[model samples]
Target: YSHHLKQGGAYKCSASNIRWEVTRETHIEYKTTLWEDHLTHQQRNSWIIAGLLWEITANSEDITAIHLPHFIDYQALNDLDPPLIQIANFKDGSVSLEPASKVHPTRVVFENPKFSLLGVIICLLPCIRPIPVKGLVMVYHSQEAADVTLHVYIIPDDPAMQEAIKLKEKGSRHIMKPPVVRSMYFGHDYLLKSPCKQVEIKPKQGVEFCYVRSGQTINFYEVYSKNVNENITLWLHAMNSETCLWEAEVRPGDLSSHGDQTEADSQYDLINREHRRNLIKHINVMQPICSNLLDYNIITDEEKEAILSHPTASEKKR
Candidate 1:
């Protein structure tokens, strides 16, 4: 789940800083071979110094064919479990081991002509299931008394399985939102913010409003307007859409014949005015709530205090 490099004075890039320049102090050679029995006759015969260098240098675009004929032990190689050898020009270099399933031919390459200790192991194919393997790199110095250093690196195959292991450490199903009916009324606009996770609204007879949550639903009947003669219930459904105002309907009550044309026009104007006020209020209330809830906490302290100070039905009754 986590990765860390081992720390020690041995692994340190510089110990006392005598400025150990690898190029000036050391003459180096590197080579790798599979166990003699594992290599075919063709592989043994065709394996010229040029061919070995070509394979090692192919992945490194900066390395050219001019640098060749590096010394390698031909007769000493034998068939072993980890089947390869590598030769390098520096005392310090990196080694990479890629699984056979994830790589073709299972090879290593130096990417740069000015070779430091960096090696890249190309994994040609994705690893499947899991496999175990070992790798080793030996760093030799020119001075006989200088200690030979070895750096080892390994990569396990199952990344997907590693992710599954990480998931086990953290418990499942934490609640993101708490249950509540968050509503605010501003001017003629009524804004409702809920942590119900889902919401549904339906228009019934009369100018009644229904608010539903997880375990209960509250209905508001004639809550806003008292004049029921020309009642027009505007139901806004928020279930199918994000903006409730976009999905709204108006149900009109029957008009009396005795009503004057001027009176009817006035009533219609009043309704229109109420609707427009409601729209503005909706924007104001939802703007703050949505901005604070969905975006960063943008609601100001002054606005929050104003909401808290405002009297409710229970306060009025008291």
Candidate 2:
């Protein structure tokens, strides 16, 4: 029995026929430029697909729930039961709270706390999905004297809020004290006690004072006696941690011993003597003479003739 011939495209053909068809057919080859364009387009499409997939995956993992804490300003501190110094949103999706009293109990409260929005933004880069913040706390410390006041600032870190605390501790460590001046005067040696603790004496000048210490009379004297007193001024000074009190005493009509004319005259005389000695020494060094020409009596002849008529034959040839 003969099998019915299946007449379709060569699907039922043998492997040889399929191979022959693949080899014989004019295989269309892609040009290099066209192939490059195609590859670029495919790559672009693949990137777009990958980007979409990544976005979808990220959205699935991203945190949609977030609890933002209330931001406190300087004015809010007065009404709040607990003074809030700083508030921070951490990287592990956690929030940290800091109290002003805990940070720096001695620090004065800020009337208007300013937030560093840019600083917060820069510091929160690591925790991008959730908002993270770094906060600053300010406290006020009244100055010992009403004229001066101190403000202490604090920053929150993993380590306890110790910036302001350290500052307060340091401030308390060194108590402010009124300045005391202790000085002695010359000629009459005595300890002079005054609100002014330090005294300045000029050259060729002296001050006298007396003080009683430990049931004994103490005399002090600061005798600034110098022959040349260019800078002489009595300075009443007070010593403090920051600065020392000072004054400049410029006494007019105080002339130096050597006048300008006398100095100029002395300098000129010395210079003239030096110049004269130099001239005499130069003349002495140039004392060597033309002994041969002099022996030939060339010096007696005047001008051109003397040089022309020399003693030696070589001189005559010249």
Candidate 3:
């Protein structure tokens, strides 16, 4: 069976006779591009998938040009050279990155000698665009979660990346948390808090959808409380509008009742978040970000000036 993303345009796997729904367990359950498992020191923090992985089955047609939906935006005809764009050919053992072309702002195209698994990977600055994409809010607490600590992640709704997170969170013992998938905007503030007085969340602050502006980076916000037994309702708050966007309940001894709780919100939360996150850092102009933040009205003037006072663009962005 041919696999497709929600857009139904970025085909995950395309083959002549084979079309199947592959899950995290298919091929490699613990691996999704699984870069970290095979990456070298030099390759570390050097690349991220353009969006999602494309897996092809056998009985496959001969390969030619494959249209991949990239995460980057090129205003001109193209911007090549530095921050190279390449086709990530997933082979039996190693994944190879071969040079490719940016045919459009949203599309990256490449060719393959024979089909295996395919995806787009870009190097260096100006990778992720500011545009919104589908996002998933995943929460978890290990069966033996020490001190009743909770781990919440706001991530893109990409299956591979989600599987990778599942792999990393093996310690959770597969305890299910109702995941909410919806549009999430970068630069906007998202806060997950517990309404119970006994439940205390740290940093006491909200996080930017793309806190680091890198798609490769993952946000794991920790929530904690001492040994208590009441079911705690955790609200995913869109702080800019002071509204509760989504919520889920976590019971101390039981997690089964909420397994069927996944749901989607309406079109707009002022702005929506992306499936993958921001990694684009190349910017000739950085002053507008301050204004952007001010327009959101989320920060105080003091906070704005402090962010602006930083010497470098990167600092200001952080």
Candidate 4:
């Protein structure tokens, strides 16, 4: 089954200046340069304008109710078989997607005025048994601009993800940590919450410690301790009950616990990090390219050198 999935074609992010492709393994691949450059000037303008409008309406907070009746029709522009991304802004400050034929309708309506829909990226891969219709919608509110929103719609990725979305639609609340989260560092502030009333993080080696106080605020009892290690556990002390809250393993430097980096891993991380920066820049500035932006190179000379200089594949695996 894995071998069959490996042969699946790529899922595309066609609207991006850089062509992004996701393999069946979920590894994202990018073309070195803009694929839309080949597009006619008028066509390219449509892409840019659509992306720009998406960046604006999605980020607006406290939107004047008067301006909510507008709907930008992007389907008329790009000639892609399946539209890259399509959005509609309704009078109620709600949004909807005009799906391709036979595809499910996607909507972004906010019940809470504090949240606003930003943008959506839909990923679909053909030939896979359980077709993974997974993508992220950029969401934000006027008050908290820095925090990330996790309202995922995993249509067919995993049964659990699909079930969670179903339960949510029925007015049930479910929360879980993301698969890839930012690493925790000494003295750095983080928003921590415990299912139980109390939660603590003690160092496996040293005297460094942190915990959740009366509120959800995380209190770092010891910062910059030299004894941070590869192994650490979060102890959730129950409050108002006898059962423990939750327990999970965590590492000091690596949030995802990717472990020691190899040459390929380092190179991939560097590129991936820059890709994320590009996405953020696009959202903030609404410019596809600017003088201050990093150069778009699929693989740099320095990176190639590092890959070549690394120990043989066998040794690196050891």
Candidate 5:
């Protein structure tokens, strides 16, 4: 997967370097690759066959909140007079990342929703058998949802569907939510809120894509240094969850010509030497970049200026 990422062509950002623009192309490539590599055909089949039930369980109590979009007729649903929604025909299904994480993948389900709408009209018009469906759903989490818009019409005789039905027959609990589009648009906030910044550009200029999250960033840098190579490093933080004290080091591909270290490093050293030593020990074993945010109470505008001044700033032209 990392290999393909290096092979994938780079998207030169002709636009201004907004947070979204800086990491847009890279996020898309990383997500598409993860869908292809991390998940298997059988796992996807299990989700389509069995996971849908997990999405629609009625008695589940974990729903924190619900918001019905204006498009949905709230009164109609409340009155049990809702408009007929097409039952999704599970012709095919695949796993797609709604959000990038090991657990996030389990919460997503994608199915074609066209057959239910068309099956009703088939008697009026002589439509071909097994019409290819559109609006492939990408992800929908059950626990976070109060009501679902889609219902599955499990095609009889399908081994996978049959298994799902048997489980249903046994009174297995399941859950459902409104179908979401397969993979959010690349510009969406899901990708833009990455904990790791787009710190550097690959100068050799082949292609690059990256997946950054709380703990690590799987960065793919395709350089013209002979053949394409994968320079992946794990990002580590001193604190769990969101904190100003987290640190990361410069990766091999992200090194700047200005210098090997940044101005923030001196500041980071002053915050806590004991913690820094322990962090460095873990970092040496992990090979992660120790970042410059260790000492700051909050990342103020002035501090942001100092941080951005590092070659790590993506807005700076390489």
Candidate 6:
């Protein structure tokens, strides 16, 4: 899997220039007669698009169209056998495959009176050569007595898989500073090596870097620290190649304790939740607030999309 999913978006707004963002939802077992004959092959391609869903919301009902970005590359799409692509718009618990009016290397343009959850579903042959994918490396750590343990995961950059890793790491500190994306093959041999002296990595001699989404047989590397309080770096690269694909530095000292939050912070969060409705009802202006939220890094782009989804000022405030 050596493919990457890049997406961009547009919504109906009066501002000549505005910020936009894209987020993904889980994949659904979509059924349609469009590709009835190739059902099995399509199923094999489902994991590639499981988190490919893109959600877009706008304020204007009379807006002309929405351009949704999908996972499949236009170049790779050209290589697709017949290159069949359809927009799966999900709403009210039912999903319909809508033919996009326009398709480009980067975007699939479409128009809808109202649309909710949407993702691109591409039909391709199962026997085709492997495509590159955007893969993620997650590093988790725990220290007990004089020993430190590190668990590293290299898996698909899917929403569902990442969420499962979150649950899997509960009470364990995620020691990675930031996420590092790498291009990988589904079953190819990728290497994870560390230069730390005397560190013991399990199954090291003839291990293959194997991974299934998250729920299945998850293949990870468990490393025992050579010395207590020692920092380490894990290197990921293709086997037989020295080129570094991705690297993560685990520094235990940089992270705060689990209970580091002060009482004032907790009280502020409580008040914010209690008066959320009051603020939503009373706010007369929303555009500035939305922009401020973006500027202050207080809300994610997904949250901004949700806030703008509401048509009215009070509704958007909510």
What is the Cα-based lDDT of residue 133 in candidate 3? 44
Which candidate should be chosen as best, given TM-score against the real structure?
Answer: 6
Best-first order by TM-score: 6, 3, 4, 2, 5, 1
For residue 125, model 6's alpha carbon misses the true position, in angstroms, by 1.7
lDDT of all predictions, in order shown?
A: 0.25, 0.24, 0.54, 0.27, 0.22, 0.55
Q: Candidate 5, residue 8: CA error in Å?
A: 49
List candidate 2 segments past 4 Å from native.
Answer: 1-130, 134-136, 145-148, 157-164, 167-169, 172-318
**RMSD, every candidate, angstroms:** 33.5, 41.0, 20.3, 20.6, 25.3, 9.1
For candidate 6, write residues 230-272 as lDDT tens digits: 6777788787888888887776573445345335557889887
Q: Give candidate 3's error at residue 74 in angstroms.
A: 21
Q: Candidate 4, 47: how far from true, in Å?
A: 32
Candidate 1 accuracy as TM-score:
0.12
Error in Å for residue 137 of model 4: 18
What shift in Å separates residue 6 of candidate 6 from its native position after superposition?
A: 29
lDDT of 3 by residue, 1-318 (tens): 322222111122321111222222222111123444445666546664456555555322323345666544343224455336677777777877777643555566664334677666666455554344445777777556666777787775555566667776765633456665444655677787877888877657887764232236666777777755778778887775657667777776644322232222223322342311121233334457754654565433334444444456656567
TM-score of 6: 0.60
Residue 294 accuracy (lDDT) in model 3: 46
Q: What C-alpha lDDT does candidate 6 achieve relative to the native structure?
A: 0.55
Tens-place lDDT digits, model 1, residues 62-166: 222112221122222222222333332322333333222111132222222443222222121342211212211111111111121111111121222223323
Give the number of the best model, judged by lDDT.
Answer: 6
Candidate 6 residue 56 C-alpha distance from true site, Å: 11
